[model samples]
Target: MNQTKKYLVVGLGRSGVSAAEALLRYGAEVSVYDKKTQDEIEAPLVNYLKTQQVTCYLGTDPSDLGRYDAIVVSPGVPLDLPFLQKAKTLDVEIIGELELAYRLGKGNYIAITGTNGKTTTTTLVGEIFKNAKRKTAVVGNIGIAVTSTALVAQDDSWLVTECSSFQLETTEKFHPVVCALLNITPDHLDRHKTLENYAKAKAKVFKNQTEKDFFVVNYDDPVAYHLIQECRSTIIPFSRKSILEKGVFVKDNRIIVKDQSQNEIDICGVDELVIPGQHNLENALAACGIAYFCGISAEMISKTLREFQGVEHRLEFCAEVGGVRFVNDSKGTNPDASIKAIEAMKGNIVLIAGGYDKNSKFDEFIQAFDGKVKALVLLGATAPKIRETAERFGYQTIFDEKDMGECVKRSFSLAEPGDTVLLSPACASWDMYSSYEQRGKHFKSCVQELER
Candidate 1:
């Protein structure tokens, strides 16, 4: 038997639980701790962990840091926490679930990170690779613990990971052969404390990369575009507007990819993509660049681009009731994301927004919503804040009901046949719904109920 070492796993969320399970599978003695009591965690996972015989610490002080070889932290746990700080002082190697997965996986990984469009880009890149018949897995911040997947998988396969700033905060030697920074915006300001700090966390994706690695970035986003000059890896860039010397871009309705020597490959046409929105087109361009780096064929890239239905909660069309289209964009959890969603609309919009504020500044949304949104229905914890900001910007804002159902009804009442009722709240959903998916599902349900 391999020597049984002890491991401490902190946080019982998806990533943390996955990490603990992986450690148990590796023949390590695992002890899991969560801030919530045993009763507070999802009943199924808690019961499952008990069956696995993992020692548990529920609703206990996290000061017991001296008993483990390493600490496996979930993304939700901050590195600067009192217990975590003490663990570091006691010489325990603190690592995230992503780091754990990368160490154990047998495949060459392609990592994607940005404030927005990361999930779409990561999933698209993985799809492009899979369409080429490559053995690939998409995991990380989006879903599935990268560390857990890595333990069971070979390192030679392609691991397309959707890394977030929280996961990036604890990463050390976890390097990727193909890395991308999609774009940077003011997001997760509450956790990162400031815009600069949040951006700095995102930039860490390429921190330990080498010359053999390729760093692909968006040259259109000023924050992300300018950071390319400081990266040490061979740079590949994608743009919807700017001309890249090497990488991917659109020209004359065709999506073009150029090699380091300026050789070109026409992947697809701009109008060929199934998913709408300028940001998604940029996402496609970036994913195409990653596919090219991973040796995926242009033909496969084109096919996937044309066939992809897009990820849910990202401008997903719910229904068209009496000429009014309902869109569930509950994934728009920040000001920039909401602004982009609003900008994507063609006709007047009845925009339903606001949730847990996350300390977001509203100037951008105010500027973007100038004449786009016909009316605003604000709800959740940040509804008052959103209303205040909208009123301060000289726009008509409605202080509406408690949940998404009521908001949807109000939006339908305010909208006409040609207008749109969009639930693209520019804040986190924890204040009302359990997650963005729940919020989106409620919107879809309300729309369905209306249809009947």
Candidate 2:
């Protein structure tokens, strides 16, 4: 915390607000910038910042940037933007909220990152740690800003964090005690420009880890397995397809952990996991691997994994109306994730799909429907794009709606008594709602409004 430093916080999201607030507390001059106007951002927050003597640049881009020591960018803000690029050319340092938090906060971090399964894994790990009676806070891309918890975190506090590629991009010294890369599928190509770039960004999660730190990875995912080639930390690979010599994996229907000394501990049976889908099995393995390495007992890990009902918005069952089940999977923000949701569902589905266009291809997503999807209800910017792909796949049952409520209604209408209406949009919720949580909540609200 430097009193003489000045920081320009970019984007008016939670990360931006926390960064600015933390900087102000450090006696640094803080400024916040958001393209959304004060009204759009809500006046209460804007007024509060003003009362704190913080400068705010909302509605438009501010011209001056060379004066600030660095720009703390929120994850949603693209670094390649001309505004940020100009800062780079001016020799001004640019860092993300994760980096800033790492510098300002004190804690032993356990970061989980991947295209999908981050929320489930991070949440499950947090639960396991809780059962072990550790002082813990689960934060980061899952929802709670890391900076918010990090600012007040003690040196021994366990910050169980869910990370995204965007948040990992600007990290310099953001090292975690135990870093897990669950899986790296193609996602966020719009901002990253390419799959390789996105993977490189995710790779940053453990870039600063020392030899004593542990790196947990999904051995079943070739991409995640590939990442271990450059890992400096001790490797802890978890797999669903293979039994590992010294990590976490399934053996004869039970989850087992093998330590460096070749000693094995049986965590639990594969059937014990309350969460469905092979993807979730991978998540369990990853979580178990994380917990075991952190010295959490096998009994605690097993108990937590079995009791976990899975994260909300990830294949969460809302209700059965008129014998039709409604499942909310709004967290399936990418094709790979939606594919997992599809695999996890039973019976025919009236699938609600499409959202913000992330420059992602939907061929695999459409193909995953596999005659299981009776009808596809589309919404948001990617509706047309996904429809085109569905047509290309020779799958014709499709409908387009303007929003989440309409999409949920259309999905229910398309569904039969025995069918499931699943809200598993294959794109981000940004195009229609601020976030996937909001989108999920709207879907649940709309489902509740449906008559018997």
Pick by lDDT: which candidate is best?
Answer: 2
lDDT of model 2 at residue 132?
92
- Clash counts for all predictions: 8, 0
Worst 10 residues of 1 by lDDT: 147-156
Q: After the best TM-score superposition of candidate 1, give how far the Cα of residue 106 lies from its true spot, in angstroms.
A: 1.8
lDDT of each: 0.85, 0.91
Kindly list the per-residue Cα lDDT of model 1 for residues 92-177, writing each as its tens digit.
98988888777655678788999889888988888888888887888897776787667767646788999999999878878888
Model 2 lDDT tens row, 1-452: 66989889998888888888888888898888998888788878988999998888887886788998999999999888888999999999999988998998899999999999999999999999988999999999998998899989998899999999989999988999999999988899889998889899999998999899999998888987898888899999998889888999889999999999999999999998899999999999999889999999989998998899998999999999989999999999999999999999888999998889999999999999988999999888998999999999899998988877788778877888999999999899887798999999999999998954
TM-score on alpha carbons, each prediction: 0.96, 0.97
Look at candidate 1 and tell me the lDDT of residue 258. Answer: 94
Residue pairs in candidate 1 whose N, alpha carbon or C atoms collide under 3 angstroms:
101-147, 106-154, 106-155, 106-156, 107-154, 107-155, 107-156, 107-157
The Cα error of candidate 2 at residue 164, in Å, is: 0.7
Report the alpha-carbon TM-score of model 1 versus the true structure: 0.96
